[model samples]
Target: MKILSLPALLFSLVSVSEAKKFQRCEVTTTMRKAGLDLYYGYSLENWICMAYYGSKFNSGAVSGSNRHGSQNYGIFQISSRWWCSDGKGKTANGCRIPCSKLMDDDLQDDILCAKRIVRDRKRRMNA
Candidate 1:
């Protein structure tokens, strides 16, 4: 026969904070899903590195203004002056997308805008 003790602990509760940012692995996976493995001579690693350096994989990151006062948005830190419209200043609206769309957890619009930026850059270089 065994006697139970009142002080015996059954299990300890672990407190885990909610994740507000994506891990590097998650960023890579998302980039791959967006079909940008080698798009425009940029490898998957290159894209991942960009996200890490740009916003530490935070999808809602917004960067400060550059010398031209153009802010960047999202994990890729897309520019507002030329690519996306921040509605704060004049923009070319090359992507025809609002900057707010880039600063969300959803990445579809961000990836599409990134593709457009790259494609447009290529066009300008060859022209």
Candidate 2:
């Protein structure tokens, strides 16, 4: 039997932790289950469209930096400028989470943060 080196083992674990791209139907189902079907008055189809365009249903997707020097992370492509902390720059951290967490397969945090973004947008529009 061969033993794996510590770095190799860690690398394997990290690779396993990477997120996956969900199918369109699967994304819709998940959104519905999370009570996001009609969240913020947006239909389920609308959310699906956003996710598709933003990350092509890729939960682990990370975008290149924008002109503002901020990058987007995760399925919804939440920006690091105001949503998440990248640990190397200043951010509002509205989601109060590490940017890396958004890249995980689990999407509960991502959904919550997305909801927060929508709510903030609604509030701003109302104001």
Candidate 3:
């Protein structure tokens, strides 16, 4: 057996093959644990609906490119244009994360970034 670099090991652990397709119940529980139950005044049901429509509960799902040639990622369909960086072009990167992170099974980062989006949208609407 050969020793693998730390980065290599981590990559192997988080490979695309490890991507998840969460069930509805799993999404509900995970969303609740992430405090998305009523985040930004949107009910958990609202978020669940969006996630289902956006990704069909597939963590590894990627959307067709937008007019900007940037794709949306993961269950939330977080956009590469304004939210996460896709490394193909410049982005506002409002989420301060790589687009890949949004496509992973783990969702804390996605939830946090989505919260930022909602907050920003709310602020703009209020303004």
Candidate 4:
């Protein structure tokens, strides 16, 4: 097998590190378990971005402003007023709030949901 030149190998390593930097531990672990390496999936990256957009990945982060008029719920920063009943137990709470409630745990429903989204996107792109 031909060996990659030093510069090419270094570039590859850098790209991977940049990709993993923002990924949540939960997303990282799950994707690996599912047989997706950096070469195969951008699922981890997408989920990390979503988490930031949702609530900066703060498992305990809540949102409310004196001007905003309501408390957003949990890590996914779910807005309770609109999704209140739907988000009954989706808050960050537990030995790490990941596998329990859908919102609170970083690895909860979001990871699985992300996996589905990424997989679909990948399929569509390939098709």
TM-score of every model versus the real structure: 0.77, 0.81, 0.82, 0.37
Query: Who is ahead in lDDT, 2 or 4?
Result: 2
**Tens-digit lDDT track of model 4 for 1-127:** 2465877777778732111113467655754675444434455465455567766655555665324343454444444333232334443321232322434443444444333434454442131
Backbone clashes in candidate 1 total 0
* Best first by lDDT, ranked: 3, 2, 1, 4
Model 4 ranges off by over 4 Å: 1-23, 30-43, 65-68, 86-106, 109-127
**1-127: candidate 3 lDDT, tens digit per residue:** 3455877888879845346899999999989998987787889998999899989999888988888898889888888888899998879898799999888888888788888888895442121
Model 2, span 1-127: residue lDDT tens:
1355776777778745679888888888888999987788878887788889999999899898887788999988888988899986778999899999899888888988888888895442121
lDDT at 65, model 4: 38
Model 3's alpha-carbon lDDT is 0.84
Q: List the residue pairs that clash in candidate 1.
A: none
Error of 1 at 18 (Å): 13
lDDT of 1 by residue, 31-99 (tens): 899998999887888888878888898878888888788898888888888889998988887889988
lDDT at position 117, candidate 3: 84
User: lDDT values of the candidates?
Assistant: 0.78, 0.84, 0.84, 0.44
Q: Please report the TM-score between candidate 4 and the true structure.
A: 0.37
Q: Cα RMSD to native, each candidate? A: 9.6, 3.8, 4.3, 15.2
